[model samples]
Target: MTSASGFLHSLPMRQLRGVGPALAEKLAKLGINTVEDLLFLLPRQYEDRSQITPFGALIPGMTTLAEGEVKLADIALGRRRALLVRLRDHTGGLTLRFYHFRQSQKESYRPGLRVRVFGEVRLGPLGPEMVHPEVEFLSEETASPESGLTATLTPIYPLVDGLTQRRLRELMARALPLLDQTDALVDVLPARSSGGWTLADALRYVHAPPLDSDRRRLLAGEHPAQQRLAFEELVAHQLSLLQRRQRQRQWPAPACTDSAQLSEQFLHQLPFQLTHGQQTVLHEIRHDLQQPTPMLRLVQGDVGSGKTVVAALAACPVLAAGYQVAIMAPTEILAEQHRQRFQSWFEPLGIPVGWLAGKVTGKARQTQLNSIASGECRLVTGTHALFQDSVQFARLGLVIIDEQHRFGVEQRLALTRRGLASGFAPHQLIMTATPIPRTLAMSAYGDLDTSVIQGLPPGRQPIQTVVLPATRRDDLITRIAHHVASGQQVYWVCTLIEDNEQIQAQAAEVAADLLRESLPHLAIGLIHGQLKAADKAAIMAAFASGQIAVLVATTVIEVGVDVPNASLMVIENPERLGLSQLHQLRGRVGRGSAASFCVLLYQTPLSGLGRERLQILRDSQDGFVIAEKDLSLRGPGEVLGTRQTGDISFRMADLLRDQHLLEPARVLAEHLMRDNARLEQALLQRWVAEKDHYATV
Candidate 1:
């Protein structure tokens, strides 16, 4: 523990031996502001520098190391003058050419000096040669262990402008010795497993791997050193989630013990029976609701997997218990859909369902607010406006959040705070139709108990998907006209790659115009994010009632706009969208019993990833499969879309690749919290940084 107050942890990069202003500026671009940053900046790969190959054994186009005595040195006279050094080993001789050389470099390559050179070898006029090879001068003094005479590997790092591998290696060399004097690499995590390396040992091995190190494992991030770091990161995430869950449990929820009668009645009234998935999830929900501790559960189902029904079933018990329920949706359209569904289900049962949105204004909004405050509204659903400061829920018992990814943890917690009036927190059931990968489910929603509705309702038919070139627009239009003439509705989804809404709206407008021009007899409607809330609602209503044959809209209709009669989906430029999005859009059409078709009209010259994404959508209707593929192809950031919260941010661990460690990390985290609170706090401080400050308390 020599480096308890390690200089490497806090000392500025400028304090390093050779880091001047220019070099420091360049290093800053790579986030290397301190000596500790330099120490943690491990190598991307390594070169075998342990032994030099004989000049005769060097092969053309192979990067190798060779050592020889400099037999001749001269400046070659040509169109490009170069410093040429002829080096001879016992077996053969090779040439070293340096195009851009300094006077010092010229003086250093004197004849009769033994040198080690590393570079790609190529067949040359004089047998073989290396151009701009890395040259190291050897001394007549005996090779010493400290001088790396027996060291076999050289570190390669990702560099920025004005930074070279050689310079970074020299910097690491200067920084590594400081670790011996300081505790910069101290392991804060307990040694929970037998196989993992200590923090300091992992850092040392990763930064300067030996010749015998497994290069393949290092590159794949499967080495024991990398595994140690990954495990620590996973544990940090687990601890954050667990602490958050603990804080949530501190708040109590109204125990809904009499939910069985109303919940059974609500299910009995449904024309169809709940699927096994829904039944199982409801059982879990009932168990959570009975607990005095508030429920933090996530209901993840594929599109059209009856998530809304499950949500409604969960709400029945709370409503019957004389407590209010609030459902928050990401979009106004989605919120309205839930409101309509809930109204139909509850109004007959004498339970009032209330609606609140951004558009509800003046007297109507005040009336809704009054109803909620007076507790007349036993169940309420709306967009984010439900969390507005003016809105208050009387005896709020449960909060159901649909498409939870669209809302962050803070937003969810804001709703949870509303139920504090009863001296308890509300039970929260967050629902998302976008299937999450298993790793994300563990890392992102791990705090919550997860219930997944695996299968769709029995009566729904499978959707047939097709991919076509955008050049065949006329053919696609003809097919759409044919479907519309048969009294079937279609969705024309227009998407723009740019963030500009005006341009995106214009794209939808252009598509609408094209459809109107081609199919004059068919009624076409348009919608976009720029539209007024009322206008969007009106268009959706008309489309739902079969008044509009084709609805052209931006990605606004990607979620919660359920038009059962709309049996065909035409996604223009489908290649521009992610797999999850494409699947969601497709889900909009297949909701009805009539045979549905999803046309992915993509532009030609599609990138490999775009092609693969489209093909995946065509090949599988399973959202979970597409989600996993999307995570692998587009990465966790894009796959999670804009739902990224502070807890989900990963610096070293890849959820998709390092998923195997999540369970073990979670178990270890639980043990730490139970047996070693101080070590847990230290580990969170080291890895989660400032994010887990409250967990320490």
Candidate 2:
């Protein structure tokens, strides 16, 4: 039962005791292989049938177990190809109907046969029926009352095509013993603070709860054991991020002498005054740029918090110091948007700016590339196309990445390395509109100098977020018509289009179609991810120019599209979106003097999480607050979509729950590195090796 050093390195499908070739293939499809993976393959849900009641006591739609005698076995052709079997207990009669049951099952359903059925029980014409109930035979030796019923919470593991719940349970049972043995070995957090529970205790408690309340508590993520495990995962993540930050800190940056003067000029040139938050963050950025070490800073602000302006101010010092600056965005549209904004800001100051992206082609792209290479383009902005082999910068000093989460670790490193190639690494600024929870920021962006813009501009209007049920579509459309009539631009976001152009597009089209009929005179433009590059750009241009009064779009406009005239954002099916997304959508409005409004339209009977998402939007416009709530509700994984990429790499830690673990882990990492750099390096190497081996197996 002990964990061997190379145990996780072995192919899991091959080592699983009862897994045959066919079952192994199925396990592979579920990404379950090796002992480690199987151990960590936590159940998606747990069904509690431990308190099994009698058939008569069971309510319709309530999952309960029923033991009965097969009074009759009738093979009658049912509507739409179904087979019906009627069974009766001493107190009640129930029918078992199967749509695809074969003739072979008939022999087992003899009149005298005793069977145990586990599924939902519904009232039928004669009495009650269980449709496609999981069945098992009853024997004298195994006829304990609990035998007919699930005596404990049944752990429902994630499944694959050919894998069954039974098979997954069996495999999990076998793997549990092995996992338990290594529970002591896997200790990453201190035992005292972990509520006196070991990892083994947590796993056992999660899988086999002794009571119904315990099952509920464990699944709800309130159990101490679960918290311990989550902490361990967070500790590992924090340690990794801290290490990355430390490594980046070692990189040298050329100190810019003109930083203060440039920053002053950038601020002076702005049309509006900077918010206190913006000024504080810009000061932090200025301080970082003044340091000899390259600045690996993350500027996180809510949508429309004027983050780009802060970034512009940071870039000014590098540009003024005769060093070229480059900004990379996640999408072409965002890139174009940044390009235009930078042009507007810099062109007035006579600072040359260049644009490059996937769509930028032929002579224009070539000319931009030449400008960048010759240092004629002091400020270059584009998508990942900026990292293409042909693109080069004469003296790149500052690299700003917008929506940093969209790009991977390698991509960020590639841009940073470009600056280092010439022996002069640039100051790095990573920006995101998605407000990361504080704990997550510590774990995910620990290496970066973090700056948060918590306030909006002085004259910025707060977007009023309102939640409306889908039944009030007519009222909402009328409101939109009224807004359109006033010449204020509106962004109607859809969750899906007719052809799946984007999930948002479908919702946008429905709203657009309805709005078109209501306000036929207003110019309406449809834009989505599936549209051609030129078309999207054209649509965006028309909207920005006020030619299009209403623009129907997907989440594509969530990041950098700026139209001060657009005062309203109607997000249809807002329940389908995350809190961060909803916040971003709302940010599209309230950028100008016009009083902006955000209508969050959702279908009735919303889920608990859905309601929480909408409520979070309605309650606050602060991205940080929304982000914390998002982490609490959805966990860090879903909140940030952190996968294998270094952006979001926590394996088990819930940021909302384990915020305390981050600083300790970060400090420990630094202390470890300081005491023995080689030891720290070796540990990181081991972790990476283990991760690679885990991926391969």
Candidate 3:
């Protein structure tokens, strides 16, 4: 084994030459703490200084290489002191300016010395000048003395505060040769794999490719070397998801085999019949519940797709078998909404409905806790408080999570564990109103089986969406007054609650006041994030009961605030929100039989992307289609909410462009885990370094 491959992977950056505390600190900012990390820091671009051009023919904005002899070197003073060197070739003369220099540095640029310079040229007070250019002094023993230039492909790396491209390229040059002497570093991929390359070779090519390599492909992230690295990263991620699912399934779950009695009773009592999509998904959930292993299923449906009914019906099996069921929501309002719905449906059947939340306190809270612990709270609904350590279940059997994307993976896993009673894990059913595209679901939720509700229930009305400029403010106000006077409710959504000054979004308070002045006969209410939970609940309740004609609120009412009577929605600066958010807001109305409409009021001079987003919303009411378009337009992070939302995130692989690699990588991951433990471990160690907990496969 050679020095580079033998120990370089574990070598600290501080051990490298010229990497003192200061330089190492600067490098650390770029996440380069080890020799291996430094090796992986490929050049962001390259400079073609291979051909030397005449000093007189150099273009001002073009970077070129030139050889010249130093005529005079001295210190010049203006607003600041500087060392200036005058160099001349046969065609023209150029000046080299250095703002900070020592006397010894000036000595190196003495007269009668041949030097090579590479940099962008600019017209200064003197002739074309190259400010602080890279200078290489030529000596008698220098290999390129005739040209006085290093005629090679120059790799330019990204640098930090105290680092320079030249210094980094030199470090790469020193490290590259060491790998040629060692055979310890091995390729993780099998030789049979197509487009495979040795790990060491890939590193060398990416850091310092030949001048003839494909630059276009490199810039577009289509280079063979880059594809190989991306594919490897995707496989590691897929393996992590597969292994997590496997680990979770190893625990036993209580089998609700005799849920027919409970399901029939619950289904017969529904006010309306279930949609075909809902029935199909419910069947899938019931199938998973009877299995010995824990059920990890995701139920995705658009807003108003009857997901709440499906969730309640799915729990009847677990509830009837003398075990507890827990339902978790993302927000207090959503949780309370679920509580009311469940209480209305279940209390008639003599079953108890337990409600708990951050706001639920005193004797009521203790009573709910006791009911949960004493096996009396057969079914429970609440926010994150349901998973708190103080809350326990006597024989927890099933766990249902609503708006699951809004919760973190740790939170979900903790709730899953809360259902573990007597070595039996609970059946887990996670629901999300934000429809996920097929490619995204395959990559992000590969570990769980997915069932999607593709259609809304009967009697649902398609929302009429329109894009209007804010100039129609007066017209919109008149329209709103007419709708409210006709016994219809309105949701006037404001993106901000207070004046941001930086943003032009209409604040909730300002919008409410404007509406009140325009239509003084209508009762308007305001709600935003800054308002207390009790206040928000009260305002939402009032708006739902039709006491408030116009409900001016922020995104707080984006989800789980159901008011079937609200048929008009006026969104101010709708372009400020994402497509999914805009879709969710549109869904708030159009729930009732009355003709519904959504007015997207936008500020003028919209951006291209913003226009595209609004246009997409205006064209489609299908959440799935809108979601796919949103993913393409906004990328995954914003579409998935945030890093705190516990959705899947990839650092190197992109779901939009690299989605083609997901299914194949997922297949390969399953094979590796089942047949090749050594290779799987190697891949996890190489790519999924810090995410080892999820890579236990």
TM-scores for all candidates? 0.78, 0.78, 0.83
lDDT of 2 at 611: 85
Q: On residues 475-549, what C-alpha lDDT tens digit does candidate 2 reach at each position?
A: 987898888788798998887424355555555677678778878888889888878878888889999999998
Worst 10 residues of 2 by lDDT: 688-697
Instruction: List ranges where model 3 is wrong by over 4 Å.
Output: 1-171, 178-183, 190-193, 196-198, 420-422, 496-506, 644-652, 690-697
lDDT for each candidate structure: 0.84, 0.75, 0.81
lDDT of 1 by residue, 242-285 (tens): 88889878877788875378887887789998899999999899
Poorest 10 consecutive residues by lDDT, candidate 1: 688-697
Q: Candidate 3: deviation at residue 637, Å?
A: 1.7
Q: How far is candidate 3 from the true structure (C-alpha RMSD, Å)?
A: 5.0
Cα lDDT for residue 583, model 1? Answer: 93
Candidate order by lDDT, decreasing, is: 1, 3, 2
